[model samples]
Target chain A: MEKTLTLPSHITTEKLKDLYKQMWLIRYFDEKVDQFFAKGMIHGTTHLCVGQEASAAGAIAALQDKDKITSTHRGHGHCIAKGAETDRMMAELFGRETGYCKGKGGSMHIADLEKGNLGANGIVGGGIPLAVGAALTSKMKKEGYVVLCFFGDGASNEGSFHESLNLASVWDLPVVFVCENNQYGMSGPVKEMVNIENIAERAGSYGIPGKAVDGNDMVEIINTVYDAVENARSGNGPSLIEMKTYRWKGHSKSDAKKYRTREEEKEWREKDPIQRFKEVLIEEDILTEEQAKNLQEEAKQEIDDAVKFAENSPEPSTDTLLEDVYA
Target chain B: MREITYLEAVREAMSQEMRKNDDVFILGEDIGVYGGAFGVTRGMIEEFGPERIRNTPISEAAIAGGAVGAALTGMRPILELQFSDFITIAMDQIVNQAAKLRYMYGGKGSVPMVLRTPAGSGTGAAAQHSQSLEAWVAHIPGLKVVQPSTAYDAKGLLKAAIDDENPVIFYEHKLLYKTKGDVPEEQYSIPIGKADIKREGKDVTVVATSIMVHKALEAAEELEKEGIDVEVIDPRTLVPLDEETIVNSVKKTGRLIVVHEAVKRGGFGGEIASVIAESEAFDYLDSPIKRLGGLPIPIPYNPNLEKAAVPQVPDIIDAVKETVRFK
Candidate 1:
């Protein structure tokens, strides 16, 4: 492991360690999903956020329990970072009755309202407008809460992105639009789809603050989200934040990934957020090498327990198909 | 009971709902200051202020998605799509996100929001502005579709829709805005999925919706002189579909005629027909269920052509007569 370091004044070492643990949890959860899927345990398809763990962990770390988040199809990371239980999420993926959605929504629709996660959307850019609405609610009720909306580079090109940004800006709603620009939208590269070099620049049209940050850098993402959240809660209006990152896995379980080169993948892996953060924790003496190893083992154990819980859970009742369709 | 225009009744329901509940608010294009495209919300901004009565950009997806988000956060948001045809722009939000969120999330959250829009053709607005796309929303598993034919039903149903736990697509016919009818001054809510028997007769049942309800009723009145007693039924809400009322009505009359202004192909009329066919009513029928809907063609700008595209009072009269004459 390489050595590197730094921390803000108020943030304790324990919190940083927790954030590291969260990133690891996201990584392991997605890996487990991939394995289970290959073995035909999980039905349907899933979009995994493997290499983008830092963005989810860092951004969510800046939010309060009262604040809300809207996630994309690749949302396991966001759900975990926002405090969704691993057992329920895993059960959902496994199509068990104990799943977050009672097995109705596989991986793409998991949500924990108590944790302030609105839900994950399967359609690209589908959750952007929803965040704006949540912000509208918070603003109207004078609730000091900000909504963090997660979408991708491909979704930024969707018309909903432009419409949502404009509405959020014009209404001065309390929201932070976080664009996880993971280099590709399905098989197409970001460069080919977007005209502007950065998705943040498009926010200029909406007259809101817009900027880009290193998504893989946990500390950087946390700081950016902190500032955006503050601005939103203080009624300064919405902001557009672009987190430039890369996803190591394919867009979904079935993707052939014929678009990107292996060399590019190798480069991104070298800058893996988890490994990078692990090095910082050790170098700064926040955790010893032994402690770091123990934390990884702890995460593995948690995941194991979650898998067992999901496997042991029963399937949804066949007679209950018509229930919950209305209420 | 006092007479009021359909437009006034719509405004009254929203105003009453907002006055009763602080969480209820309105958001859409030109809804705040401009009072919407048809002046339905003209005085609302002054009373509720810009905060509660918000004016959004011309973005249908944002209007819809934001409503879903706000509803998830415990707010009752009413989104206006300007015209029902514009619903196509926000289909992903309405069909995928809002419709699936509750069931997919294991019923942990409910989107108690109403999406209101003017539908049907007759004013020469042509294709983009004048299509009745209720069937598109009704086809979705998790959405409730409602259409009110009169001023009384409009106010009552609007109130009901605002209070519904699920997302509702409320279609208000454009031509019916100025139409007048007896409405109660006291606040009341009609059950969402119940069918109202506008007129009772034993010869045949005319199950019509929205503007078609008016046409069906008029046809019934004309057919009375010819000894063809037609029973006109308005299925105020389509999704939950008062199947019992429809089936019972068909059984009593021994003949059924389904009418709507939407294109005939794949319209909600087909769904109603299938429901009757699969029920005990199929054996009691004196004649096959007659499905009457608009022609499967884009509504043209010319007044004559626009009128020709959809079923008018004459067509309803003819269809009712044919059904009564079948056996």
Candidate 2:
């Protein structure tokens, strides 16, 4: 086991506590999604980021209020980390009329414009170009806001990822390309699909700085992203940061987990980001057992209320179905 | 009013918009120093500087998706694809992201972006570079498709597309760049969905788009000497088709001939024909509706074959005669 690490000087106990709460909220929310799927409550399928909590919570903390993000299909954690209301998100997942997209878009298309979340894309590497465009806007308008684009390790193989990074580098756009290398894309293993060991190594092709980080290490991710965001804001250029993480759940509802063995899952499970951070907090005396338990209870209660709210919401009307197709 | 080439008109539209609003910027390959593939953006880099008149790498997906992201983040970005056929490389970003983001977000935000591409085959650029792909984008519900035939319409409609809240795909004809028309120097915008009656006659209504509009007009002139009166109508914008103007013209003329440069199968002409068939205009039609478009094949590299692939002025004349002759 790794020894307990001290928090960075810039990080306060209050911020870590908030980050802990957000991670718990994401964990509970994904657990509820699994439960809802088993009971056939959610209409369409969903991609869960259960074990990839620290990546979202830590990276988002480095961004400013005006900074924008483009999320992936498995993006509830990202949305929640960027400040989306869980009730609205739950309602959207339930296909209710009050949902983010009025039930038009399921979990894959949730968005929060006021919070600077562009939207989660259903296609792999779909949001990378959009993140670059947002960065272009910030640069042309002198908005002084950076853009954080999130994708999976599998998406790094997409032409969009390469093209977007190249454009961002050439134009010196204010963007951070964050690849959550969860070791798999659906059932395909990254080792087999890609020739390179580190996805970040490909960033050299675009003449941009690239680094691989321990996604489970909350403090390290925050510090790395914080510096990257600062560099982008100052018009330095874009950076590719590959965060090594894992997803405990199957790819989707239909996934049977036939690819990998339980040994591998167990090994990654022992490194659960939320649990690791919690252990650090306890070891450093930042949180007592009662305080940590109360945080878990608080997250569970919030998710419970969200589920009830979604269940109570009405379905969208047929007439309004065509309303939002155009401006 | 002063006469200017269609290329100049497009440049003026972007320049005027960029001057008036700092949020408006132009980006694409060779758009800055190289002045674009056709020199449409010549001298723009000098006026607006590299930041506003951005020259991106040869990455179509990034150009499109980046524009969408910029639009979402409060900047109005005008992205140019070097050629219309090249848009195939960026279908996911343009079709899946830019077109659906607003609708998928439940209309919470709009993508105020314009994608400008030179369409149609005249320079013998071959299969990969010469194409009229506007019909593919027009099929998307959330996108607004515009094809400006004249210099005046080019400037005015471009201004309108920029002001529009939805994503707009602006198709300029490569052959029409040198074609001159009177354009007003002051700022103005044409309503997006309105159709323009280019020429008025009693016998037949020839609805055309892009380069085909000029062909239809030339056909009308040729038929005039033979006492065969022909009316010409340019729908201008396809997605928000000016069904009323088209339907009314067909009602008065008793015949309809839709012409375009795209392949006949599943082209926008079919959409126009279907609109009339589904509307009250079907009852007033004295003759069968006709559609004249390119053959269902890729544009060839040879000048003769390319000319033979799509409609010429003579084809429009023959199509109009056949429509009027039909019982």
Candidate 3:
């Protein structure tokens, strides 16, 4: 068993409880998304982040209200973790009128700027530069904020990632570049796709500190990001964090997922982060077995309510075609 | 009063705006210590320092993305694309992000920024460097497109663009940079969406923008000699089009010729023609609405080919002749 290290100030009992609830919510939300897509209720492909709940919840655990995040295609978890409404996100996935983007932007493009989620972009490295820019703005305006940019191992090859890291470092902008090494980029495993041993090692070229963490371990994720966030808030510039996580499901809803063996999925499933967290909470006497069951049930009920809200929500008016173009 | 060229006019606009607002800053390739390729932002680095007068790497997408992100976070960013031809590289940020953000947020946010780039064909810079692509931006609903034909309009319009709650694409013809005009020193502004009737006439309405505005004025002089009075209307800003002025002029003369440097097919000229056709002006037309535009060919390496790719004085002359008709 990999024993993940934790910080003294990190993962308070209250915080862990909140993380458990959010983790359960995202798990239920992603599961419902899979069902909805299969039933033809949701349009377009969704990269479900079901088993990778700990990565999203733990990474965003210590983010301030003013902090910003840029997410990837598998971004619903990131949005929900950052406090975006489940109903609006589901509505956006449904291409409904009441969506965050009023159906103009579907699943991959869902965003709530007020909540500091810059939206999940269709392009792999599209949002990378934006995170750097937002951090640059924070630095220049003395806004005392940080920007966390999340991308897959595949995006490590993009010129934007390199260029953005360079710019952020040169300007000493408050940015945390997190590479969610989910072991695969649409069937191409991270091992096969990247030449580097770890994506975090790429940060050395930009003269920024880099580290690899157990992405599935909430304690590790919280501790690693806690230091990175603190350094940025104190004007120490950016950090490159590589989280070695695994995805239990296929890349998208339409994926046959025949590329990987069922045995491999079962092995990763046995090491599920949600189950591990639950076990940890019980072992530490932070949460009883009944409390965990009640939390999961609550999350399921909340997701059900969000689905009803999305189904009854009206579609955006056609007049939106001409609005929000420029302000 | 100061004797300044069109290039100087742009520099004055940028310097003045930066001085007036702490949020205002400039970013582009070779625009800081090296000055702009066309010298539009010369001396800006010295006046405002490298932080504000930022010289970015040769990355158009990054420039546009930076502007979009910075603007969203309450900073007014002014982006300069060394040349208009490279705009295609950043069309995603310009068209999808900056133009759509304000309206996408239900007008709750404004991208109060400017993208000033040197355009038009004449310095023999050839295809890859020389282009008058203002029409492309004008087609976008949320963007404000402006081409200042004189130093006075350049200074005034830039001030207005900086203060505007929308993204403004301010284009200065490459050749127009050295042309001088007597502009008042006191504070002034040219409204973003208004059209100025450069030379009023009764025979025909010659609606020209950017460099063509000057060509139309020259063409008007030649037409006057032939007893054909021409009204050359300079639509300073294209998106918030001054349709009222254009429609009124078309109604008065019963003839119209829409001229632009951009290639004809689906160009901004089509939009103007469509607007006139849809309005009451269609009933007052003495001839078909004529549009004189660039030849439908890629700008070539040869100076003459580049020159032929866009509308010139002769093209405007021919359009006016055809539309006015020989009574």
Candidate 4:
């Protein structure tokens, strides 16, 4: 393992271990979900962020409890990073009454408002404007909190992304846009889809600061997002930080991934964010190899328990189908 | 009681709400100093200041999405889309995000926002600027769609919409903005999902929405002189439609005619007609349920063409007369 590691003042050894554990949690959770989906246990399609865990973990870990985040469709990592319990999430995927959305939302729309997780949107660029609106509330009410908006590279090309960025910039709202630039957007390569090399560069159009970083590097993600969050908290305005990462899994359950080559997948898999973070933790003496194994075992056990809970949970009653449509 | 224009009534509702609640604010393109395209928000920026009465760019998606985000974070956002026709640009945010957030989140979160837009033709603003797309939003389960036809209904219903813990689409007809009606100076809120009987009769029932309400009333007057008594029912809100009032009215009159400014094809009139057909009112039919709506073409810029595209007083009068004369 490489020993060349520099830690920020806010990131202690314990925090590093916690983040490493969270990355593992996201990995185990999604991997289990993928397996369950194959067996027809989890209904509907799911977009897994198997290799892009660091971007969600690092960026979300930098914010306080009062801060909020709006996530994308492939947002299981974001939900976990923002403190959602795996059992409830699993129950939601199971279409049980105990699920986060009472079996109404399914996997695409899990949200925990009390945890500052506004919710994961099914639409590509749907959550962008909501983040700006949340920041607007923070600014108008003089609430000293910031909002971090998580979107995919594909969403950057959406009109909502441009409109949201412009509105956030003009209003000087406290928001940080974190774009997880996973190579492909539903099998469409980012390079072919966009004219620009970096999605972050588009932030300049709104007169806001933009940065692109190695999304696989957890330290780099935390540092970049921390600065952006502080900037927004202090009323300096919004910033767009594009995290260059890749998704190891296919876009959704039914994707054959015929659009990309196997060599490309192998290359990205080699740069797995969780594996890289675990190696760093061991090298920095934050986590020993034995402890790391135990952490992985604990995550597996938690997932097993979540599956049990989901199986035991009741299906949503027919009587409540019309409920929750209004307040 | 004081006579106020529908535009003034809307503005008053927002201003009063903002004054009463610190969390209430307004945002939209040209809504601040420009006072909006139809001047519904004129003189508002001065009263609430820029923070509360915000001016946004030409970004309807952001305006709507941002309002959802703000509303999620304990703020009541009143979003104005310059024109109802432009809702197409922000459909994903409004339909996919704002309309479904609460239900998708299992009732854990709510979007307490009001989307105000000017709808209907007669301004010669052409296809892009003039349209009555209320049916599109009313189709969504989680959204509350209101089309107030008078100054009194506009103020009261808007206040109720702003206070409701759900996303409300408030449709203000462009032609009705300058029309005056009696409104109380003191703040009041009309309950949503309630139908108002604009006029009472027994020979036939006329269910009209927005600008069509006036036309229906005028038609009722003209039909009265011809020995045809028409009962005009204004469905203030579309989603939680006052089915009982409409059903009872149809049951009493034994005749029904649904009218709206939107195209007759797939318009909200279909929903009203279905509601009547589904209820016990179906047994009390004197004639086939009649529906008068806009022609199934884009609104034309020519004054005469625009007038011809939608239902006018003569159309309503003719429909009522025919229904009453039916064996």
Order of all candidates by lDDT, from best down to worst?
2, 4, 1, 3
Residue-wise C-alpha lDDT for candidate 3, range B76-153, written one tens digit per residue = 888999888888987877887778765554444567778888887767777777666777787777888888888989
True contacts kept of each: 0.91, 0.90, 0.39, 0.96
DockQ, every prediction: 0.84, 0.85, 0.46, 0.88
Clashing residue pairs for model 1? none
Q: Report the C-alpha lDDT of model 1 over B110-227, residue by residue, as the tens digit.
A: 8999999999999888889999889889889989989999999999999999989989999999999999999998899999989999999899999999998888988988999999
Model 4 is docked with a DockQ of: 0.88
Give the TM-score of each candidate: 0.96, 0.97, 0.94, 0.97
DockQ of 2: 0.85
**How big is the positional error of residue B327 in model 4, measured in Å on the Cα after superposition?**
1.6
Candidate 3, residue A281: lDDT: 85
CAPRI-style docking class of model 3 based on DockQ:
acceptable
Q: What is the lDDT of residue A211 in candidate 1?
A: 92
After superposing candidate 2, which stretches have Cα over 4 Å from the reference?
A1-10
Q: Which segments of model 4 are wrong by more than 4 Å? A: A1-4
TM-score of chain B of each: 0.98, 0.98, 0.95, 0.98
Error of 1 at A197 (Å): 2.5
lDDT of each: 0.90, 0.91, 0.84, 0.91
User: Number of the top candidate by DockQ?
Assistant: 4
**What tier of docking accuracy does candidate 4 attain?**
high
